[model samples]
Target: MTRSTGVVVIGGGQSGLAAGYHLRRSGIEHVILDAQTAPGGAWQHTWESLRLFSPAAYSSLPGRFMPAQDGQVYPDAAHAVSYLADYEKRYELPVQRGVRVSAVRRDGGHLRVETDSGDWRARAVISATGTWTRPFLPAVPGRRDFRGRQLHTVQYVSPAEFVGRRVIVVGGGNSGAQIAADLAHAGTDLTWVTQRPPRYLPDDIDGRALFDAATARRKALDAGSTDTGGVAHLGDIVAVPPVRAARDAGLLHAKPMFTRLTPTGAEWADGTTVEVDAVMWCTGFRPALAHLAALRLRGARGHIATVGTRAVDEPRLHLLGYGDWTGPASATLIGVGRPARDAAREIAGLLGS
Candidate 1:
């Protein structure tokens, strides 16, 4: 039996929850299908000590404000997960967890979504799975032969696991910098290897303001306008404070890009070698669009093409939390809500509500 809904949301994370909330507010019937056992998407699987670099004020969803003390740093991953759970309950969003969507295709004039549990037919669908679906580990030679435990930053939970081991963290992004600092303080012998030294940002700019200038610049770029020569033209895309702290703490090393992994350790492009007990790859993630193979995606760099936020080919298909449409803010908690609300309004109009 095919379970039918007015609209089917593909993810139950912040974006999906926001979409569901907006749809419900408009009195539209919809159901959210998520692969996880509960809400909070990737937050549920993030490292134990991870915290938002943005303040609580910037981390809110559509209708709720993040509960936090004044001047306090952003919520950690656990706190974020708890907040998302509460958001779901408060809005009474219709979500079906543990239903991994395997495929999505257009059936006649409607959308057909096939999942592990069953099939759902709906008038529209929103892909809010976020950008971190697949961890992108570079194809370094000899990685299979590495004897030490090599893991992605996604699998890292606590520094205690590497307390007595020599750990090498690869990458210069926020994750790499933060993990290096944590492990170094945890008494683990650590080395942070990065090809490009990151441009760090101050934890608090003037008057304790979180640095959101990057997001604004990205939005301008996406809108086909060049950045004005101002504060935005100051530095690299990665923030500066964490990187500076990591370097000051003796955790960062400007190494060549990873060339390969040997049974003993890793080799860099510059032929330098580092022997260690573990390797933590903090490399970024790629969009998981394998399930959308049936949809003819027309975009550069393997992304689905959109004309001003709506899919060019699929009318009812819209992308949320994608940096392509709304800019870098699309990926952050603070940035996703407004676009999600806009998408919900568009979806409601399409449903003739």
Candidate 2:
């Protein structure tokens, strides 16, 4: 059976929630399809120690502010999940959970959303399925032959399992720093490997500051003014309390990237080898857009070209929460609002509503 709506939102994560909020405020009827059985989206899958760089009050969606926790300066994964679940109910957004989208194909004047549950026809579609499900691991030789356990950020729950074992955590981003810290705190014999020296933001700076910078850059771009540098110049790795303490204690010293993996461990180009019991890849993730493959919209970079959130090839389709390409810092909880609002407005206009 084919049902109809003004819009269909894919993936009910933070981005999807923001899009839903704006679409509701615009008085546009839409339904959000989420693969997760419950609320919280990717937060549900994050490691127990994962903490947002900002406080609850600083990270929020379009209509509601995430309420601050009783004692946490920076909310943990659970708090984020709770906030999203409540936000969905508070707005009474029409979100259909446990519905996995299979494909999105053009169907005359509307787009057809094919899912395991059924099909829906909509004048527009918003893809907000974020990157959690698509954890990325670089192709290092001998990875498959490694005798030790390998894990990615998406699969990692805690450092408990790696305690008392030799482990190498790869990647230079926030995840790598945090996980390396977590392991060190747990007394794991750990080596942090990175492609280059890790860059840490000023101790006082946080996600809010980054978002503000991104906002300034976006505004400057809209005005056709000089590039404001945005968050690019600010540095990587936010020094949250844990990461800061870990680094201060010399527990987070990083090793240069290894040339390849050995059956027992990693080997550098200089022939130095370190044997380890496990390797943790905190590399990152690609956008979860496999369901859109049938549309044939991906460019050479494996991304759909976009002007703001609207896809250049198909204006009826807008992507949210992927990253800067969709909107500056749009992947962050607080930064997605502007792009979501713009996408909703553009979608409404396209629908002539």
Candidate 3:
């Protein structure tokens, strides 16, 4: 028999959990379906030493605060996973683990969500899968010819795995920089390849004061002002400035643009080459919404078109955790809760709750 619910959340990560928490508080019945066996999505897959650059005060779910004192650094990947597990148990959120949602289609008035277990029907659906559903590797020449074990950062777990090997970390994003620095300290010969110059910011820039400044600048820019470009260009919000410090220490080498991958290593656009034993692609991630083939997507990007905050074409569907609405804040743990709450309120109104 097909199961039915008032709402079905597609992911069980921070955003999804927050959505579920809010919905439950508002007396909305829903079930969360996650592809992973556990609650934390990308966090469970992150490297061992990864910690939230945002303090614990900002990196928290809806009801419960992160278990840390004031001004304490947020937990690492494992600690985050444990905290999420505890949150699930504490709230008694109904989550179907290991049930990979393969397809979602509109069936009459309700939506049909097909997973490995069975099909589910829901009156409303919130796609909280976030932006990291799929690792996006750049289409470079000779990628297949690379005989080294090339893996995306999502599959990376620890630098100890690359102890004595020559490792090449690709991309200049937070993940690439952090991985390069971690492996460098682990006695691994490391090289970081990026197409653009790296940008950095201090670890605790004025102690959460930067957030208010950034938010204000972001608002002013939204109101059509160009005076905030300097603050806006201060690198990604999730980025930790210490990565550049590692580069200054001569532990990381930022190379030119990527050209091709070879059996021995990688070749750059400047005719330079590095013979590395392993390659970790920290390029970034993209939304994995291919299963929603029935929905009218905004072309190949798979993003739903929106006017203001409401979805233009599909009013019943909603997108949370997208950077477009909330800026860089939407994608971070600190930024997801507000959007999730807004989405829940919108969904509730649609359901006549």
Candidate 3 C-alpha lDDT tens digits along 116-200: 9999999888777876768888888988898889999888888878988998888876788888888877779888878777665
Give a tens-digit lDDT track for model 1, residues 1-353: 68998888889998788778788888888999899997788999988767676667668887898788344465678778888999999999999999899989999888999998889999988887876678888887898899989899789998988978998888877788778777876878887778676656554442123225545565576678987432334433233344455667776655656678889987776788888999899988887667778887856667677654467789788777766353345667776776777787888789884
The segments of candidate 1 whose C-alpha lies over 4 angstroms from its true place after superposition are 69-72, 205-215, 227-247, 298-300, 326-328
Give per-residue CA lDDT, model 2, range 1-353, as digits (tens): 89999999998999999999999999999999999999999999989898899988789888789999888889999999999999999999899999999999999999999999999999999999999989888889999999999999988899888878999999888999999999999999999999889999999999999999998898899899999999877888999999999999988889899999999999999999999999999999999999999999998888699999999999999999998889988999999999999999999899895
Name the better of 2 and 3 by lDDT: 2
Candidate No. with top TM-score: 2
Each model's C-alpha lDDT?
Answer: 0.76, 0.93, 0.75
Worst lDDT 10-window in candidate 3? 203-212
Lowest lDDT 10-residue stretch of candidate 1: 202-211
TM-score of each: 0.89, 0.98, 0.88
Superposition TM-score, candidate 2 onto the true structure: 0.98
